[model samples]
Target: MNRATVSSSLPSSPSRRSFLGLGLGAGAALALAACGSSKGASGGTGTGSSVLKWGWALPTSWDPVFSSAGWDVHTLSLVYAGLTKLDPHGAAVPALASAWKYNADGTRVTFTLRPGLKFSDGAALDATAVKKSLDRGRTDPKSLVAPQLTSVKAVSAPDPTTVVIDLTHADYQLPNLLAGKTGMVVNPAAFTTNAAGLASKPAGSGPFTLTSYTQNAKAVLRRNPTYWDAAAIKLSGVEVYPLPDASTVVAALQSGQYNVAQIPGSQVEAAKAAGLEVQVIPSMVVATLDVNSSKAPFDNPKVVEALKYAIDREALLKTQAFGHGEVSYQPFPKGYAGYDPNSANLFPYDPDKAKELLAQAGHAGGLDVTLTTAVAQGEPEQIQAQLKKVGINAKIEVIPQAQFTQIIYIQHDRQVAVDQFAGRDSAVQAFQVLFGEEGLMNPGRTTPPELTAAVDKVTRTPLDSPDYPTVLQAATATAVRSTPNVFLYTVPRILARTKSVSALPEFTVVQRFEGVSVG
Candidate 1:
């Protein structure tokens, strides 16, 4: 979900920018596939108008709970209001719910909604609606946001203005979790029809309403003047283009056809040189080579251990990041609270050790292993060359990230893959999704139950407890030892907008357009 929410298993597409950047795939393929032409398009690119044209990749779905693509959240959030919103720093902030209070032990939590809030469809957004949305997400097995609320026993409304959530375990981070897509309020009217039926017809209480939405096409949103928090939004309308290629997004920004653009870091200087305003937004993404433990070669712990010393993370980060990132030696980034400062030293760059381990594991000359990545993302040739040095023949296979998701996550047929494990506002969110049980959208290879249980124990540990950091760091190392994922590097998040555009505030992940205004 890398909003980071959602898994790679969603109905496919792409997000997390820089896809079609320097040395990457061409953008015309994505641009041509989209509804070609028309700055005249209704998203308000009209002459001398008070409208904001936001350009980025399309969404998986409009259903707030069902939506997983990260880029979609930026625009969709403008149309749907969560109980609370996660700030750029990942802190929970007031939104639809003005204030909240928790019981002494944290088992029971109550939220107080801002007065007189109404959905885009004219339905009152009361405590009952909050309960409906939460219960639906908690019960839906496929809901990406459900795992965070696994401890919730019931969602009840004690009164019209107050909603109470009863948790079986004491969860201090429930407020932060609720501030995500799962806790986003949705109208029961649209949901009553069918789950998939709410794809394009999402009913919400935000600054905008969905006038139109087409898969792989542009989404048109009109201003909701009646919105409770609509004072700062001066735009008459907003049009979001789901352009896949990074080049296309840059082109849109440069051409003055798009007011706001989510540009890749590779093109920051280029976009800036083109006179586009670049917002250097810091983001988190852990590039890793996951060795499917369920399969051969990787099944041997020594062979998996050998990989830790094989690749040069610093060199890889330099090549991939263009000097914009640092090596990610642990499962979680250093910015994460529980990150072990010593994990980077766990496996230093030692090709000799890597070779010896491989030979000891009975792969003397190294066995042939396949590495899969998106067409533009995985410099498969570079990796293929690097693996050759260690006598490990790594064959490269490149495909679209969307197809990559379908194969690795949905089909679960991948043997070894070079994947990007996105950073989450909550550190446990990424761990639970990537390494937990298969049911929680563990897109990576299945780990042993012991690993899962140990990781789950960390999630249950109170964040404030003294043992919290120890448990958190231990679980990460334990999982890494399982050889499911080889820590790679972290990349920066970037965004670009026209100079004329106003109020484009930055967030770690684009959660919402709180005070965005367009000239």
Candidate 2:
């Protein structure tokens, strides 16, 4: 958010020599080396002792409004403070806005800003800035979060600190919804000059300011001294490197390249053996098979139903996730409010029934289709073998991880792909992104009428009502019975960090860095 940091040029896919030539510093070079290395990094402490080197995926876009990936919400959270933030229990708490109250009918909500909040640009980040961001999120054609704010009729700032949001109907999901990407406020001055430039140059009131960034390599951030919650942020700086490879995670953490890093379930023991503290924290993420309903094999309802019964969720739990996952039948996890007990075994593994359904659908000889995925993991191969048992011959097509989002979410060309959905903060928003007409994961862009009506009941019901959870479960049942997405298993986020680092809380959504410190 500092002008000096913002003015720094962000180079794309530069060679090692060219990267250092940019003069970003030794930290940038260490991040690149760590990112590209399979073996341990050239040690001797990559960065300052006060700086936390984190190994994680780089955000697809820096701007929350234009970001296509759901996980980007966490990375952007470092630079942009939202109106509300979620506690460890996933409940909404105040951040920029001190407090908020809804009207009697729940059709309007008023938020009171904390006194004297300022953006990195030294501009007033008051009610007017919040209104502008909310308006843009709802009205901007390019905003990926627009679907979550369709019910917002208008956003108004009556005074310097009072912001009001008028909704078309009674909706109680706003607080939690705002806690995520939709609630993050951007500097109006920066966006007005060049909206697209905000993707690389961010200006927010979050705890950290981007000092330097190189695409697919690393992002170096320095502490924002002016952050409203400065006392909570302990790290002087943070160096983030994109290390998506699970195999390299243990080595990276053990070699002092990354003090904390996300590892696969299989690597948990390895991390523990290396004297690193491990936390296998439960998450709302569900690995599912995204089926294009408008496509060839899936157009037939019977074919879609057949594939649902074809998969063995238990086998996938053991094989694909190495028993670090729970077999799931719906989008919401088992303990979540939206999970439906009745729908747990709606389409249990029954190859005979699957074959019968295929025969009835005039595909008795079987049908050939593609199982596309970005990662070359055992899950897709396992799914391919299982589908073959029910006469569904699946050819696996591996696409580059960089192009996966473009092909599946943007271009909508995938027939059936393996995707892990990092569920949203609100169940209503999660449903919209999974089964709604404009959902990013729904490549076919099709949703059943039953699902739409069911989710509507969830939004209208107040969160305080006892019937709220029931309506949510009903919607889950509808989605489970009607949608083509095959729920496989729920896996926890496995993180390995040094014993010196502490205070990593268990968050239901993406990982949070607030209060995390390296002692």
Candidate 3:
């Protein structure tokens, strides 16, 4: 069977449309879409072969429904095309679906799929396939996306190319929400035949197909000729290897074993000195101190406020991130629509103020607390030292990184801990995960009524509406003022690659290789 036959004559995508008009669309829809190793770079095919050898962590699971790690969203995207993809600006654009529109009041959204699309296995990727994938996302007991799809009342397929999503309330954020794992469509037949096997084998109509995979080690992919916009794909294939150790990245790149890798901020100078092209891309990652407000000490609002003021964000940025990031006051990055400028100095570093607040909270003699962490090297130690000056003694407790979330997030057995937040696809989604009552980061499972109201307003506003930014910023302010978390800094994703590599873009802070080339 010839793979090219699936989309031998599909036309180019339609033009950009506003959220109020034909719906959310961007330039050349379905366009643009990493990681890691010490393996031979370029697969011995030379630079012109367009094969990317990347040093990055591999996904925990290929199937989006079963993948528990939010960080895996970008890696999984290489094999599964979501209904909507994000633009460089993090706006929702077309990918699998050519165009989409919402009805009056925004309760329902209709997506029109590109015609004659096929999975790598030659299965039709039509509206029915989308319905099946979305239904499973909300109904499957093992699905990690069920929580994100609660607003989705039902999904209906009216025709081969048409899919209508019925929402429980006005939700203009669905397009952005679908730009991540929740929107990735999988081959129904593959999961039906062997659901458990999907952890290794993925069947999707994406830009690439899984040619070979080794769990936690390596994954090789070949470009799918049947992809809707195959002509836009410049790379013949992509090879990824898990290179978690930051110290090894520069050596791997300089040794010609890896052409592209996510190096740590500390390695930035080393990579540049080695003549490697380094891209310090602004990211949504926030290194934060999560305070469980339900627990003693923090249960008192003054205590939480004191902890906030005690954090020296500038010092943390220089020490932990090596001055490669900005001091952050909220979950959203600066210049993003959801970021609030007024909150930039919300909690100025004031040890005296923190001490006064502590006394006001009835801890006049100083307080003792536990600072749990998965990695106890850089920031955790700095944080512990800073708090001591403000009369807060923090005992460092280390836990395995793998079990940190389960213990702190799920089990709610933590008082305060250092954690990294990988931002979500949508601003609203980020707020829900960071501040919602049941948000994974909210160990205490509490949400202030004002914060909830502000976030809800963001959902009701259209993505293209002039009022959207204000609504999102309003929500950010609410969360900043009431949330029980101290955001320390925003770390940029430092990508070290050979000069030959170019066009590597990031959407929603996830590195994309689509339209990228090696030579």
Candidate 4:
């Protein structure tokens, strides 16, 4: 099995106590025909609300590979399909690939693609296409999605329906990794049309085909009649509209301009009073504060520990999160297999201890730093207020979503950055993104040998092996001890829709239109 390793030293102070105080937390309509008129020219399904006007508080962009915006994934999921899909609960399940078998060494994986699958453009989905897609990701150095593929040794087509992938290291959680939005497959022919064709107009073998799109405005998708899983599709078309303001999203939902929209925790009661169906699920999304260890003050382990101790997660959670989330101590949230109960209780709220550690690091009075974040569902203003009490002066700067990737992921200059991680199908998914050598989430900027080794052990070990639990525990321990980043809370995803829709899945926050229906 191929394995990737990471290493880092433990900080001088013990891990802080777990944060517990934070407060947490699709459809259609039809037109009516004249009474007993037997339906004239407008007969078919009463037009059936052909377009699903979805209102989200984020901008729309066709470039899925370059944009980290969650809205991009929502659009891409409609236009493209991956080899494997993540279930509602964030577990990896087969999608385009009918079945898969891992070699005993775990370094190699062979997938039996479903035969007769073809792109909307009528091109067959064979091993060559898969290879081409993988190759593009590997070769594009500027691509954020490419680093996920450490190395693809070979991509061979044993037959029209089989694609064998040879990896440089054993990645037991490879399937989950592929399920990420970044690993979406694109049509090889379309990709070659222009060097950057896929970025603007993605082509894939999904239930819906992108018919039209307007950047930062709206996108339209039409049903793919040639879609292999057409029978499972319900809606004829979907229209996604970007509504970035929280108040605007609430107003739209109430006005019936949108069938579905994200409701902030503060508005849950008001939505319920208006007779809308409100559903809340544990979101895999987490918000955290990243300390820049590569720069001054924070370069010292003591300063990092002091900072962690000073911020009261409970107060932040209660005030900013509206009591809708759980305090997170590590990258892996509760309900995940790798979550460490012991580590969750390790850190306690202690301002005195935090001050002592700061003094030990040579900053007895306090320090001045700039905190950066993008406006989202959380309470950034309130979180900052709590940080000020600990002797640190934190200035908040909000940036646009398009510039977020460059500011946080690439530049990595902020003193403390508030960021989020999308839920993944497996623990390894969290491990790779937060601790992998080139992981985008490692804001502390430390890549120690010990941290790398621990993460490697967890990724390489088979999920069913006896030692799997041990490896997970060790990795979590390593993360807490090193304090690469502070894990805050798992925010709940609140979605509101009309009662006309049914059969919604339970696990993922993203809607799967297959089983959904209009009354």
Tens digits of per-residue lDDT for model 2 on 22-69?
A: 111223222211222211211222212367788976676778887766
Candidate 4 local Cα displacement, residue 402, angstroms:
3.3
Error of 3 at 374 (Å): 0.7
Candidate 3 lDDT, 403-469, residue by residue in tens = 7777888888889988878788888888878888888889989999999899899888887777888
- What's the lDDT for candidate 3? 0.79
Give lDDT for model 2. 0.78
TM-score, model 3 to reference: 0.90
Global lDDT scores for all candidate models: 0.66, 0.78, 0.79, 0.65
Candidate 4 per-residue lDDT, tens place, 159-201, comes to 8777788989887777666765655777888768764645546
- TM-score for candidate 4, residues paired by index: 0.85
Point to the candidate with the largest TM-score.
3
Better of 2 and 3 by lDDT: 3
RMSD of 2: 9.4
Residue 67 displacement (Å), model 3: 1.1
**By descending TM-score, how would the candidates be arranged?**
3, 2, 4, 1
Q: Residue 433 in model 4: shift from native, Å? A: 2.8
Runs of candidate 4 exceeding 4 Å displacement: 1-50, 57-64, 375-378, 423-426
